[model samples]
Target chain A: METFILIGITGIGLGALYFLIASGLSLIYGLMGVLNFAHGSFLTVGAFVGFWVASKMGFETSMPEFILAMLVGGLAAGLFALLIEQLLITRLYDRHIDQALVTVGVSLVVGAVLGGWFGNDLRMFPAPLWFLSAIDIGGAKIPADRVVYIATAVLLLVGNWALLKFTRIGLIIRAGVENRNMVNALGINVRRAFSTVFFLGGFAAGVGGVLVSVYSNGVSPLIAATYLIYGFIVVVIGGMGSVPGSFLAAMMIGVIRQFANYYATGLGDFVVVILLAVVLLIRPQGLLGKVRS
Target chain B: MLRWKYSRPLLGLLIALLALAPILGANPLSRPGLQQTMAVAFIWGGLALTYDLLFGFTGLLSFGHALYFATGVYVSCILINHEVVVWWLAALISIAVSALLALLVGAASLRTTGITFAMVTLAFGEAGHVIIQRNFFNLTGGENGIALNADRIPSLFISVANTKFIYWAALAALIFTYAVIWWVTESSAGRVFAALRDNELRVQVLGLNTQRYKLLAFVISAALAALLGAVMLIAAGSAAPRFADAGVTISLLLMVVLGGAVTRWGAVIGGIFYSIATTRMQDLTQQESFKTIPKWIGGPIAEPALVLGLLFIFVVMFAPGGLSGAYYRLRLRAITKKSQ
Candidate 1:
């Protein structure tokens, strides 16, 4: 029972990380109709930049320097996404295939540049000392880091909801997701929404970068690349562009994977893939996605 | 239509010269490294052509085509290397299994359209790679990759001295691939494929099941990729995990796009160009003169991904038609001007 409890909690922690990545992917795909291959690079940029900031700022346990690092990382990633949107994505306009291909190119270039500019080795990312401790829950000892992950995800989720419901940009975004052509006909600047979506998506992915780095032993150039596959799966399963759906799917997949991994080592990934195929077979449009055509 | 009579003889002659290039160009290609590079290029050209059948002709953008190619290698290598079966039987079985895999995976992936299809195929391919790298069932040798067992390999296709035969085999395979693709593309089904790419709604209005035609293209393309993959194993004498990597699929995409998607010649040329660039560019960077270049320039130059990716972007942006498109564009203009 204790083991099960611990494993289940760890699964949620994993899901929390997956949701952070998937939410960005889901929102971006929903609005722009782009399968942004470079989304992973945003996460990587955030992680590397965040680490650099931490190193320079000097880690102080009492001062909460990691939070600042995470914020700065997300902001940097957001700006980078904006640049890509303006320079590459906007030029392609409504050419969805071209946009997707351009993202693939961007992803390759960014990954290569990061690898070439700053070696491909995995390096340590220093976390707050408080994150090193554990808390007991239901006789199962849970890592303190899991709590932070869940909190951050929930906070972001509510924040995303509030932004969408309460703000003018959010209202335009909501309308654009339903029918961008119609929204454009309504004289709203749907293009600005594209940039906003990219920025926001990149921000979430950037945060995911820091969270994922903290979850593991360290960060490597391929860190987000490894996670990007799962993010895609999550986005597809959750119904592309549905935040609430993503949260549910991420948690379900996470728990299922944890249980599967417990039964047999490394079986979870295979099981998850099968699950995706099965989902695709049954629900081609995804769990919450509207029929595109 | 006007010069179809002249084009056939010219094309046949080009192929004949290609098959006999190893002997005719013996001076330069005799270098084992050059021969091996050319052999890989031929296989890539074949793979890219098949990929074009799906992506360009059928309008399916698959990022997971490497799965079928990897299936051919792993199945054959595992059987041969582990002495599970004779080489010929293993090779036949590998090809068969790859077709079956394409059917199953294609059926599942074809359920989704556009971006979803691309992602689903990618996931399935990534899963295959992971299974191989993880050494599932303790058969794949994990990260070490599987080499063709020396004892089981045929006498005609083993050792550095036999690089010539391997080179010829790869050429034969490429020619066979080209012929099959050409024949299929000329058939009625090929017309349907073109229709499906241009407008599925119109095809659906004609009461045709677009999915069935798409599946046919997927299976045929995958089968062709598998055959070339077996040839690839023979050429390289091993199956590395990277054969199944997502990077390989991306490279195939690069080949098709660079050569021009709809044009068969573009696929082959793009494959050959990409292969030569990949192998030779790294070597080019390794040269003494290149070593003295500034770090800023040298670093990006050394990374093939950046260069190839930039080139792909350039093609997509400026030359949407690729090399064949550019050629056709110029030729069409000249004809128009002359007629006027």
Candidate 2:
């Protein structure tokens, strides 16, 4: 029972991280209709930036200070995304393969530059002392850091849901996702909406990156590709542009991965791959995705 | 000059030069290193041609084609090293296996078009890489990989250690692949593939089974890619998991794009150009004289990934149609000017 609880907690914590990353990917795909292959690179950049900031602030910093650093990092990533969207990505709109290739190129550039600068070594963000401690609950010990991560993820998820449900910009984004032409016909600036969504996606990815770095205790250039694959898996399983579906899929994958890791070393990735293939074969549109007419 | 009458002769001349490149290397003026590089380039050229057959001709942007290539390399290496088969037999078996694998992967992945197909394939490619690295059944030597014993290798492949012999073999392979692709592209089925690329729904509406044709193209491409992988294994006497990496697929994609998609001969040129350029870039960065350059400016050059990424972006932005497309346009302009 204790082992199960521990696994559940870990899975949920990891799931939260995956959700943060995949939500951004899902949103960008939904609103902009552009699959940003460079999404993971944003996470990598954000993590590194956040790490640098936190390291500079010293270990004595509180949780709020760390959160502030992560926010600043996310903003930086958002700025970068805006520039990329304006200069390059906007031109390749609706050219699916070209968009993929261009974004892949962008990812490669980002990853390579980071790798060159960081010397391919893993860098860690210092966790607060409280986060390093564990609390006993009903004979099961759970790490406080994981609880914090889960809380953050839940808060972000709610915040995003509310933003999409209630805000004007979110309404425009939702409309764009359904039918960009229809939204444009309504006289909304679809291009600006797309740019805004792209920036938000970048911010989400940036925040996810910071959280992941803190959770995993290290960051590396390879994280971009690895997490990109994970994010894609989650998005594909959940159905592209589906937020709730992404969250559900992310959690399932997180748990599945945890179990696989415990039972068979190095089999976790293969299991995920198999699951994706099976899912793709069974439901071409994904678990929660609607058929795009 | 852009007409088939002119281009056909030019292509023939290029093939003839490639065939005689090893003989040309017999002269001291031509370096052995050049021969080796060309050999590797020819193998890459064959791979690129296969990629173009799917991406350019069939309009399928598969990101997992390296799975088939790695399958060929690892399977052939394992069979030959274990004395289960000679190099020729291993190559044949590898080709078959790769075709079968392609059929399976295609049947599943082809259900989705565009980005979904790419993502599915990417997932499979990563899976293959992980499986190989895991050394399932101890057949794959884990990450250490399997090296073929020189004694176990067939006599024909034994001579592959000779740079000239490998050069000639790779040239022959490239020419053979090019001929096969050329024949296919000129066939009725090839026309169907072109139609599919232009618009799949239109082809489907025309009563043609687009799925079957797509599968056929995919299987052929996979088989050829595997053949090239086998050739590389024969040349190197070993196979590594790195061959299955997504980076390899990206490199092949780069070659296809840089040469010009939908153009067979362009892929061949692209492959050779990409291989040579990458090698030259690394060499340049490693030279002692490069140390004198400032760190910031020189830093990116030392990292080939950065350079390749930048090159990809530059090509996509400024030269979407690639070198072949540019040349064709230039020729068209000249002819129009003359007529004017």
Candidate 3:
């Protein structure tokens, strides 16, 4: 039971990171219909940005320093996203295969760039004071870092919900998702909306990247390929355009992975892939997807 | 109808020229290294063309085609090592088995389109790669790879003296593969595959079974890929686990896309271009002084695998129709001006 809970905690920690990364993927797909094969590469960029910032700040335990680094990393990732959107992705809009192919190219370039810049080593920042102290709940001991990560995830989720539900731009973004053509027909600059959505989406991925790096204790260039596959699986399984669906599906995936980690070691990637395949076979449109067409 | 200008006669002539390249360069380009590169490129060209049949003609982007290709190498290696049959017959059986596997995979995965299809194929490919790398090590020869007896096939020319049979065999296979593809692409079924790519739903609405057509393309592509794999192993005298990995799928896709996917001859050209650039670039960057260059820039940038990936990006960005598309554009402009 202790091992189960501990594993579950770790799974949730991973799921939280996945939820953040895939949420961006879902939003981008919803608004733009892009597969964003380069999404994981963007995450790598963000993590590296955070790593560089942490190195420069030379702070060991300050929450403010971490927050600043995250913001900077997010900004950098957002700028990169804008460049892709303007220069490459925009041209391929509404062309499904072209979008897939172009982004794959973007992924290769970005991955190569990261591999070149960082070599193959992992990079990490020390946990803050709050996350450094573990707390025992019942008979199970949960790491302080997991708690901090999960709580922050929940806060971000709530904040995103509030922003989407209440803000004018949020309503416009939602409107755009429902009918991009109609929104453009209404003389609303759909391109600007796409830009904003992409920025937010990339920002979410950037935050996820920092969280993953901290939890894993480092970032590797290969992580982009490894985690990108998982993120796409989650996005597809959760329903391409559904934000809430991604969250729910992420939790299920996380829980299952936790159980799998308990029963089998060194099989986490395989288990997740199998689960995704099963889900795809059973529900082609995904769990929350509304239409079969 | 299109001029039908690129006929089988032209293709035969091209193959004849290529087959005689070593003889033509009897003194120089016919050297072992050049001959080996040409041989490898021809076999790879066969693989890339088959890949194009699926992606370019049928409009199905598969990330697991390497599964069949790799399966062919491993199975043929096992058969040859066990003395089950002659090396030639082993290749046929390997292709048959790989086709059956592809059929099973295609039946389940081809039901969906777009990202789902890509993801499913990727899952299967990774699974195949991992299994062969780990569980099937006995037959696979694992990381050490499997080697074959040096004298496997009958040699016809002096070119076959030292690893020279590879060139003749690969060239023959290349010609055979291209002729088969050319014939298929001209057939009524090939037209339907092309149609399916343009509009599957419309085909279904027209009382034609798009599923069957997709399966046919998938199987044929897999079989051709298997044939290429067989030839590659025989050429290298060994088969390694990486032969069946996701990277091969990426490289093949890059080849097709880089060469101008929809263009038939472009696939072959793309294969050669990709093969030469990657190998030559690696050779250029091996110097100690060159090591100072960023790994992404000049050093490993020439790694065929990495270069292919970058080309995949560049092709999509700059040349949607691929290299063939660029040629077509230039030709059209020249023709229009002449007519004016």
Best by lDDT: 1
Computed on C-alpha atoms, the DockQ of candidate 3 is 0.35
DockQ score for model 2, please? 0.63
Colliding pairs, model 1: none
Q: How do all the candidates rank in terms of TM-score, highest first? A: 1, 2, 3
lDDT (Cα, tens digit) per residue for candidate 3, span B130-217: 6676544377666777776545544442234555667888888887888889888889999999999999889999999888999999
In candidate 1, residue B136 scores what lDDT? Answer: 76
| Candidate ranking (lDDT, best to worst) | 1, 2, 3
Candidates 1 and 3 compared by DockQ, better number? 1
lDDT of 2 by residue, B1-340 (tens): 5855667789789777766655664663145677778888999999999999999999988889999999899989888888998778998999999999999988988888878788888888888988999888899898989997778765655653467777777888898899899999899999999999999999999999988999999999999988988888877778988899988898999999989988787888899988888888888988999988887667755777788788888888778888888888888998899899
lDDT per residue, candidate 1, A1-293, as tens digits?
Answer: 99999999899989988998888889888998889988998999888888887777655333278888888888898899899889889888878888888888888888778877777787778788778788999999999898888888888889999988999999988888888899999889898888899999889888889888888766767888768888889889989888888888888888899999899888888999999999988987778877765
DockQ each:
0.69, 0.63, 0.35
Superior candidate under DockQ, 2 versus 3: 2
Model 2 ranges off by over 4 Å: A59-61, B4-6, B25-30, B155-161
Which numbered prediction scores highest in DockQ against the true structure?
Answer: 1
Better of 1 and 3 by TM-score: 1
Q: Which digits, one per residue and each the tens of the lDDT, describe model 3 over residues A145-217?
A: 8876677668767877887799877877888778778888888887877887788778878777777788777
RMSD of each: 1.7, 2.1, 3.5
